[model samples]
Target: MSAFDEFAAVHETHIGVVFLVGERAYKLKKPVNLEFVDFSTPQRRLAACRREVELNRRLSPDVYLGVSEVSDVDGGPADYLVVMRRMPEDRRLSTLVKEGEDVSEVVDRLARMIAAFHSTAARGEEISAEGGRDAIRQRWCDSFDQVRQVGVLDGDLTAEIERLTLDFLAGREPMFRRRIAAGRVLDGHGDLLTDDVFCLDDGPRVLDCLEFDDRLRWLDGLDDIAFLAMDLERLGATESARRLLDRYAEFAADPAPASLRHHYIAYRAFVRAKVACLRATQGDAASRRTAREYADLALRHLRAGRPRLIMVGGLPGTGKSTVAGLVADELGAVLLSTDRLRKELAGRSPRESAAAEYQRGIYAPEHTERTYGELLRRASELLAEGETVVLDASWIRADDRTEAERTAARAHSEVVALRCVAPAEVAAQRMRERHGDVSDADPRIAAAMSRDVDSWPSASDIDTSGTPARSLAQALRVLVD
Candidate 1:
């Protein structure tokens, strides 16, 4: 075919081989015995090949065509193969995230798809029992043991991770029990990193559902998505990950606790490190370095970083939220939007029309004061818990900026103010072009804010009239460093 053999390319994963022949691909299960799975025999590998097509079809129905038996060994009925269509490399979600393509819309659709998948996924006594408190603890503890036995990670870091995981799981037994009783456990897509997902025009086609072991596939739906979430965090797509979790929780009506989120993120990071170590043992040089990197990521997840308060402020349409979103994602900090908070507080739809004049109606000074106070309250709470936070608001008044500084002082955190500035003409144009935004700043309000804007000499000013990506990179250099 095309001056070559039928198979044009070969790929090797930890437990499988893939042969890419033109637009079609065939996967062959590796005959090996790992700690979590056994595919040592041809019969077992064949069954796993069938299971791979069967389980992954639930997520990527169009991509996973079917199973095939291909004979390339000793001219006999030999190795089993999974035949499917191959997508372009650029369409992968991981690639899009790395390339900084705007995939916010795709992430929304992804959350919906995952939520729907979990709703229809299998859940019963058998599955729920496997997702019980003890079972979940055992799974994390086993991960710790495995990573430790691998002898690749730092000893003190491992001890600290084990300590944190054990303490969190032990303290949250009741929550796990409640989740199990609620029948929220399911046979989910167990390995949900970005590499296995494709963001096609239709939507995301998720593949690789960890089919070798059924026990590994059974999990709490939250735990299932956390793998992708953790991967997103590591990829510096933190805001997208946050939005995905929030949308999924809102859609599923199954909000996970902050502690549970931390636990699972650490677990997923450790698991990533373990997988990288496996690749390293097989003489993959890049994976050898990646193993340590993932281990360091796990260590960061297991421990709390120094708390800081990031202030993103600007007149309307200077792209405060855009820069703050990037800063929050890079730091994995909590993002609080004043516009969303105001809409929430006013008990009004974000799209509802508001014809308020300057400091009139719900935009009155009293309401403004209350919103700022509540925002600071929330920031203080998160900071007190040793989590960094980013507040997206217009710090027009010097008094309000002082209040934020005082709040950070009380919480024992430093305040970093990033004032986004665009020329008056640019800001005016942006306001006129704004659509479908949560912010209620019309051109009139933006003009009013611009006229009344006060200068903050101490604040670092970032010109945001240029390209958003380059502007954000500049802001991150200041905010993160």
Candidate 2:
């Protein structure tokens, strides 16, 4: 069952082998049933070849020629092959990136092309189900089991990554539902590695999608794009990887949070790591190292995407609320203010006048404890579901700060304590000028609070005596550094 006497080159992967002859490439499915794919029979292989061509033509129409039947000497069909126009070996996106080429324009065009493709890709109830939180959790659990079974990666690290990934998914059910409602789930190119993308003179030709499993192909658009973004970062093109996501978000008008982007990227990396583990099991020694590298990348992205509890506290009129709002905007975190939560918990409006002396009436020790307790309770719930939170309150008591720390610890989150400060006169003036705000503190109350304020050595002091922008900058630096 041979047409060509000699092949120019042969490239072999776990699933199939490609024979390059002249200007055409022929792909033959290996007669083996793997965990993720099946090509163990002639009939199945033929169907797979046909599916590959039909699905791939959506992106690379000119390159995918058609499925060909390889016959025996009796002219009876013996095997099947995916025949196509061979792309230039030197023109792959991976090759160009390795050569340090300035591929900014090419990356931009590719992002737009993928965005346009996703804009029209299939989307319905069935496909949207694949983008749900449960679907994502299943895939992650599958990868974890496979990786653990292989016994190649470090067990402790694997567990940590697994916990972080699940925690991220736990808090994002609403976000995932929003994506489904907005039609972000689609049947897309599931295998979007850079090596499969050919950067040609005309534009780019993206090929070699996961054709064996339709379930795998049905995913959120962000998950589809993340495969390539993960590959790009692995290739050391971190900036290009970032730009691609940014441009794609702009083109698609995707209102995804940064945490979601990082989470998806981490998921892609873990999937590749799973593949590498499989390769290692097949006796590919170098794949073992690759598996570790991918696992590490996955861990890095997960940590970057983990939820945080940012505590912005100081005496009243030191601009704690203002700084907390800015930090929340910067990190896309939920902002919780004592003033707002206290009012909501009680039977009062946020702007209703509740002017009272410090630690009295609505601001009593018992009532204040309830407000902070409620804030921590709400924050713990959000953090459990992978949401970052910034709490704005006068953290004058060490007991309250300790409680916040304990809450963060329970959620496996980092706590950033920021103590906002201003000149005494500035604070007094701000309190004096307070009008329709939720805060009931006046200059006299501010002075009383300052005297009662406990020592807070752990928190970074953000001086609010200057402009709001300056205070925000200081707080952000503390968060970053």
Best by TM-score: 2
Predicted candidate 1 versus true structure: per-residue lDDT over 162-226, tens digit per residue: 77666555444556777888778999998998988888888899988888778888998888888
TM-score of 1: 0.61
Deviating ranges (above 4 Å) for candidate 1: 1-7, 71-76, 280-288, 304-481
Cα lDDT of model 1 overall?
A: 0.81
RMSD of each: 10.7, 4.8
What is the alpha-carbon lDDT of model 2 when measured against the actual structure?
Answer: 0.90
lDDT of 2 at 295: 96
**What TM-score does each of the candidates earn?**
0.61, 0.82
List where candidate 2 sits over 4 angstroms from the true fold.
1-7, 317-322, 329-387, 395-415, 421-442, 451-481
- Candidate 2 deviation (Cα RMSD): 4.8
